[model samples]
Target: MSTVTSEIPAVEATQFQHTPYYCEENVYLLCKTLCENGVADATGSDLFVVFISNEKKQVPLWHQKASTRADGIVLWDYHVICVQRKKESDAEPLVWDLDSTLPFPSPLASYVNETIQPSFQLFAEYQRYFRIVHAPLFFKHFASDRRHMKEPDGSWIAQPPPYQPIVSQDGILHNLSEYNAMSGADSLSTMDPDTVGAAVSQKLGVVVSHTQLEELFTKLP
Candidate 1:
């Protein structure tokens, strides 16, 4: 694991306000804000939107503030966060999970160890899979109609974000499912390293196993 150092100053977590239970929208706003503020360009960091889920849609995450248990574990259908990969070789990547109780921007290693818990064994149904999307392409191609938060009868499962639903630059109305769906067979270990970047950018994204999560950004060119 890469050690956390003070060389990089922390970004205040409270600087942005996030809507509860709206992780995908929260991360979308985060990436937009960071780009508008020039943080991505100034730091030479590439941003990625990571969706955590599985074929069964029952992914377990720890250290989530939404957990009712003492261990801060939550069984979520899906969850999203923003990861920033610095261009500098010595600087560790950072995870920005607005819903987490951990540091605002936790180091990738610490987030994986504490929140992801890749070392912990799990049943086949609960094993985690990650869909990693390059932020620039995601920003351009992503759209959400908020249909996922509704009941079959049209009642809301949860309150919706105050802002209007996000639409893709090319006028795609809804493609949330395209990004959220993860199959067990789409592990990064199976892909050629040279094609990973192209695949992620040209398509929706790449789905990787829990064990392959941390090394993903490092391996991408």
Candidate 2:
């Protein structure tokens, strides 16, 4: 038997914030396959099916919620997976394939130019996920768990600080304009962190602990 050279990380249940959407669930599995086996076809590919919410236009018809008003949205930030395909070669039998499965309906359907720009930008950024396997890139999306923080004097802050990106994946660093355009975010002149710690402090207030933030910042490029 051939000895395996490396091990892969599995999708932790906590990585997902919302209840796993069908697309999210599929992509999660696809990511695992890609991490382990590289890239392949639908039947043979071993990558998690990554899902990125289409920020442009309304959600796709197929991705829409059926009965309940359940945030029947299709497009999201982004999702991606790596697949393995067999090649006739003298050495290794498999090679990696990056397949982007857009949640947008009819993906090629024409739409108003204005709404489409943002979604396409989001799609481009999602491509960066592959860099995670080779090098770390700083991609920060923040959500605060208010339950975990307490002010030293015992008062609660309404909102946490804005999130900051930390470098954990390989890719070109994102420019301010790129970040703003992809996230549809306003100028962060006043709030974004030049350092991730500042960004966390801005959201969590001066009193909140930043032990984790401190550790992540130590690895910055």
Candidate 3:
């Protein structure tokens, strides 16, 4: 397959809105926004996938980490990213994870090569099974729910303030190291989160309440 160029000019990394703690979902929406507004030449509703890893075994896990509560409860079961094209002509889709500590819009090929050590995949059918709208609509209805996360210190704060870039300038190459495990693609196999996601969140000192879980899903299309 040939490489397809992006529809829109690739915005410099610094242009991205900075945030305190943008989680997996926030980036999914951001990428979808890029696609919808033709920012990256994206068209239609959007395309994204949700995936879950058992432990530190999943490389992406090492980057964004998962959503949790102050009491240390886990919320979301999977990490999701928008798989979109910068333009209609692009060959392979780009995987955009705004919260990723690795890089903002990782090429799907590179993403699969480095991340995607998976046993199961639940392609988030936002357009098919779920309805996806522009950010304004989402905010009008669910902004309050979407905002805020429990900090390690136990204070609740807003997430992904605005255009927070995925990876910081301080450790560009260092953050990329998370996917070092992907280089061993020949040895990789598919696997699911063997341990309960909540249990794992507890171990990480994060908590997701029942209400929070509902907000995570129902609020989105």
Candidate 4:
């Protein structure tokens, strides 16, 4: 929700650019301006702004921590790299210095891309019954203090419950938690999809057919 307004002039790239390239140039300029301001944490090592210069168009949004930097610097310090070049007449270069502007979208976007987006359809279908379907299963593999791990009824705390897998009609699986115990096992091989879907619906407090579940999964990101 934080808002940052900058009066600094846009760094113009001396070339005609379209929406995509112009956006990149703007981001580059924003980074340059932010690097000049030097608002990074003093205790942490200096941040360096980096991005691809077009050879690699699919530049990841995450600012990688330069492993070769000797100053113990972190990626958080230098967060922006306003894209340069490819400017067109009458097209305003856009800059997005996450350091000085809105919060960086990499972390959240990464989570969505690697986790949420892939499972979006599954989550949405399950959400109709259980709102918490999209939430990461609150798992407790081991407790530091086992003695203190007890429920309100004085019973031993049970292991965190895992959600049943919802398979799609096309056999495309999503949200497979590699860390989960049954992650290596294929749910469809042993258990029927209808049975699994029914259990999931029961746990979610809603009744849905396997086809409906598959449809829901198909509709999401």
* TM-scores for candidates 1 onward, in order: 0.91, 0.23, 0.41, 0.19
RMSD of 3: 15.3
Error of 4 at 169 (Å): 54
* Most accurate candidate by lDDT: 1
Candidates ranked by TM-score, best first? 1, 3, 2, 4
- Model 3, span 2-85: residue lDDT tens: 344443247554554435344344544565466555655343323433233222323223344343533222323234455553
**Every candidate's lDDT:** 0.82, 0.26, 0.36, 0.26
**Sliding window of 10 residues with minimal summed lDDT for model 3:** 125-134
lDDT of 2 by residue, 104-210 (tens): 11111221121223244333323211111110011222112333234777675333333332221343233222221222232122322454333222321111111
Model 3 CA deviation exceeding 4 Å by range: 5-9, 32-37, 40-46, 49-78, 85-90, 101-103, 118-154, 157-221
The list of candidate 1 runs beyond 4 A from truth reads 1-4, 42-45
Clash count list over all predictions: 0, 39, 19, 14
Predicted model with the maximum TM-score:
1
Evaluated at residue 220, the lDDT of candidate 3 is: 25
